[model samples]
Target: MLLQIDLQKEEPIYMQIVHQIIEGIAKNELKPGDDLPSVRSLGADIGINFHTVNKAYQILKQEGFILIHRQKGVVIHPDAAYLANAAYVEKLKRDIRPIIAEAAARNLPIREMEKLVETLYNEMKGE
Candidate 1:
């Protein structure tokens, strides 16, 4: 899996790592049981600190997106699909609430926001 990190972006490096890894799963680029680079290795590859990569990995593991093993290392969660439950939906809503609020505050039409979401969804799915 490849993660592209933009140092100039507003989001933190660790968040970028988290988002891209999740996107890779969505795109079918990273499958269940697929091995991921070690935190130190990935950090060096992406030109970031090891702790940043570790933070992202810990979050992914906590959220059921990845699994960490002492010998096998890290891999996509075998039962990752179960992550899309009601609680996940609620969390998703909470996460995107700020963006939706900003769009509303800016007077962007609902249709436009819907289109934006559709476009991003398709792109993430590699459609």
Candidate 2:
């Protein structure tokens, strides 16, 4: 998957990597067991420090999104489809609550927020 990093954005570079990789998985552009570039290579390609890519890779590994093999390098997790366990659901809720709160604070009605979410989700799925 192609990744575009914006240095001007307030979000950190590693998060951008994490988001794009996950989005790629969501879009089925990155399939389970697909090999990924080494962290050093991706960092070089993105013009960022290797440690930053390492951090993103570590998070993906911890979250069961990717696997690093000593000899094989990195690949998308083969069981990625089984990742949405109870803990993951809770984490998802926790991660999104702040955005939901911000929409409420801005007086974006629930229906509007729902619509916006649907649009984004559909776009991500390439539907």
Candidate 3:
């Protein structure tokens, strides 16, 4: 997985890592059952402490994005389909409501947002 970490961002480093991985999954860059690098290795590669990576991985695991095996390391959860769970849908609304509200506040056009969503969907399908 390729991730860019911004050490200076107001958001925590672990959140950055988590978002990057989430985006990778959304973009199909990381498929179901794909293995993630060890926490130590990923931390070394990103020049961050291992605990940061571990925290991110634990969050992902808790969110059902990945499975953690004691001996096998971490792998994308085989059944980890996003946007399919009621609880997850609620969580997504909680996460996106502010963004949508802000966009509305900025007077961003609905048609433009629809087009962006269509474009992203097409890109994900490699269309």
Number of the top-ranking candidate, with lDDT as the measure: 2
lDDT of 1 by residue, 33-60 (tens): 9999999999888788999999999999
Itemize residue pairs with steric clashes in candidate 2: none
- Residue 41 displacement in candidate 3 (angstroms): 1.3
Better of 1 and 2 by TM-score: 2
Candidate 3 per-residue lDDT over residues 69-113, each given as its tens digit: 989998998876765778878988999899889989999999988
**Model 1 whole-model lDDT (C-alpha atoms):** 0.92
For all candidates, the clash counts are 0, 0, 0
List per-prediction Cα lDDT, in the order shown: 0.92, 0.93, 0.88
Q: Write the per-residue lDDT of candidate 2 for residues 1-127, one digit (tens) a residue.
A: 8899999999999999999999999989999999999999999998999999999999999989999999999999998767477987998999999999999899999999999989999998898
- Model 1 misplacement above 4 A: none
TM-score, candidate 1, is: 0.93
User: TM-score of model 3 relative to the true fold?
Assistant: 0.87
TM-score of 2: 0.94
**Candidate 2 deviant stretches above 4 angstroms:** none
Q: After superposition, how far is residue 77 of candidate 1 from its true place, in Å?
A: 0.7
Q: What are the per-model C-alpha RMSD values against the true structure?
A: 1.3, 1.1, 1.7
Question: What's each prediction's TM-score?
Answer: 0.93, 0.94, 0.87
Task: Enumerate residue pairs that collide in model 3.
Answer: none
